[model samples]
Target: MTRDITIVGAGWAGLAAAVKATQLGLKVHLFDAANAPGGRAKSVAHQGQLFDNGQHALIGAYSETLGLIQTMDLQPQALFERQAMKWQYPRGECYALPQDAYPLKALRSLLFSKRFSVREKSTLLKPLFFSVSQALWGKTDDTVAHLFQGVSPKIMRDIISPLCLSALNTPVSVASANIFMRVLKDAFANPPQSCEFLFPRLPLSDIFPLPCLNWLRERGARIQLNHRIDDLQDLDPHVPAILAVPPWQASLLTHDKYPQWSMLAKHIKHRAIASIYVKGLRAESDSKQAPSSSYPGSLMCLNDHDESEDCVHPQFGLQRDVNASTRNSHPEGAEHWALIVSAADPNARQTIIENALKAACEQLKLSDVQLELCTVEKRATFSCDAHLQRPPCWIDSGLMAAGDYVQGPYPGTLEGAVRSGFQAVTQLVDASFVSSHAGNTSRVL
Candidate 1:
């Protein structure tokens, strides 16, 4: 059980740490509670179809993620679709968010698209104008909303808010300006092609974790699945263990040799994501039409007027049954479509899913859609709330923590998780080198 490095959790962060540690010639033991890898990003099977737990998309600016993908040598195109994305809204209204999916094509669409008023389009340019300056020099106390409020009418409510909420998983009003600026810099400052948004064509686990697993195995890293750490013990003085387990789990382990670091533990919050997958009998009539295509899934916020209180599931995008086009009718007489709704609060999920299903039906014009199978998944992940209790990247001597909960500008995102792992590995490698050098110098003296 003695390992130079022991990584808990086989999610992207843990996997990333293993990959990097193995590269540094360090022996790593990777452990996870899941039977397989990919944590939240994994896939699930239902009846005959394979569906992802949620829809995940990455932008060209995700250099680190893309680099990891390359390192695994997985065909990016096989798993992901790197192309221009369509920003859809109600009334069948759609606009192309400016990036390299097709820069010239998007520009032409923006100029003529009726998605915004001419005045709003002019306002949209406000971000482009200030994006460079902000990116280069960095932003101030200006929150994303504050900085872009008056720039463009369309930009504020439509573009900025939606984009910010989607990326940060928080409302635009409170989303950080620095993080928002980093997004702008990645898009506008980097090559247009580099900004191409990437969405996995396959399930997320296939896209996120499987590749890392294969890569780690080839690199000689040991992966332990279904092996949850019950407790941490025997931390001899000056020996530190990375407590990368969940905060709740960490609290249970507080009686261990090291409880002082557990103070940063209370700041962590548990957030739940509830997803309802509905499979219904497809009508024989619609069999000629394509089954799955996403609409810009939109829901009206309930409470906040500034759209702050409304639990607008920006990521609540849609998935229509692609099988509808080919088959005249479901053999089982069930129409199929996947509705995924995630929220921090479980009580609110019921309302969110009911309203979302209604909106999805109206948008897809499938009012007669009957639910054959409705499955709900709760306890999706920990909340990545702003100002939460987050510990530093490096904790005690020879020990470190890396997960979505660690110090980062963003919340519990794949990017945040991976970044934490990357940073943790960096600290571990650097510290080890320094330790070795110091010991050698002392012996010589």
Candidate 2:
């Protein structure tokens, strides 16, 4: 029997497509090489602890991603902070961007914050006064560095660069000026809290993928696991197959289908990330007067090295040294803090972890704590490079491709992945309607 749809790769993109398509009343078949779902966000159990292969945080601007999560009926509180992000600089000075709608609050915070130089603060506010002409015009034909020309190197190095790299997973220089602009637009457009930072509290498998997987099974969607299709020819002669695989892998399949896929395939680029996970018997949050789930400086740029101190700021999530001891198992003195660090460059994985651990200890003043466990994960993701080729939703008659790699305005993020899947399913539905109409006409003939 011809299934209504066959989606390749059970990653976030594929799984999202499966759920959405199935809900649309199409029979869905999802194929993946991984034993589980969530792809890069998958989780693994280390001893008694369940740790995600990497860390993922959701922003309030990510409405589509959050909508999907909400649709799955997962408890939002379990998966996200749903509050304003709290940032701590290396000097122990702290800032809370606040989770509220007042732009004035953000403006005030910038004014009083000691983190930025007078010049830096002015450069940051330049966005507010940017010519309404240029604002409407969006990104100029300049690099990110060009965008921040007069800003202090400190602001760029410590703040903007880290935020950009974490979101786009590319260095500021390499990231598209337009992409970075979108990030700014979202932050400023929403109520300050609308941009709340949300990371998965449970393992990623459970947070994002497992619920969808279970739903697919209950709905009788055919899910094939541990099967890697190295070649497109390996797929059955099924029309409407969605090739929701990665870029390098997609490149191989597109070589023969240039007439069909060359344009889309060329727009996709891969960036790599490494995640270092450390176990804490106590939650790092307990140590602070106000516990924080994420720290902005944890994921710093490759070049932002200050050797005077051994530890770097925890930019993305936790800030602590790799050598710091896990706290006790409760707030009294315990709760494990899992320090997860990520960077686009694969080579600097070790050094980043070392520096991160060092910084965590220095900032927390926990040099005397006992160590628990440290593990590193490389190949976190393929950089979603700008100007790469993207394949179409439908290809080779019965075959289609989906995933973040499919055509989209944004890079390969959770939103992009979901959008791609939604697009492929739409294409399939349209094509099916046309095919059915033609068949009925043939009978009349």
lDDT of predicted model 1: 0.58
How far is each candidate from the true structure, as Cα RMSD in Å?
5.7, 5.6
| lDDT per residue (tens digit) for residues 334-441 in model 2 | 324444443434456556666556644554334334434444444444454444445666666556677666666666578778778777766666655212222221
TM of each candidate vs. truth = 0.76, 0.81
lDDT of 1 by residue, 357-396 (tens): 6644554445465543343334444444433457677666
Q: After superposition, how far is residue 361 of candidate 2 from its true place, in Å?
A: 1.8
- Report the C-alpha displacement of residue 242, candidate 1, in angstroms: 4.3
Off by over 4 Å in 2: 1-3, 125-135, 138-141, 259-269, 279-315, 319-332, 368-378, 384-398, 431-445
Best by TM-score: 2
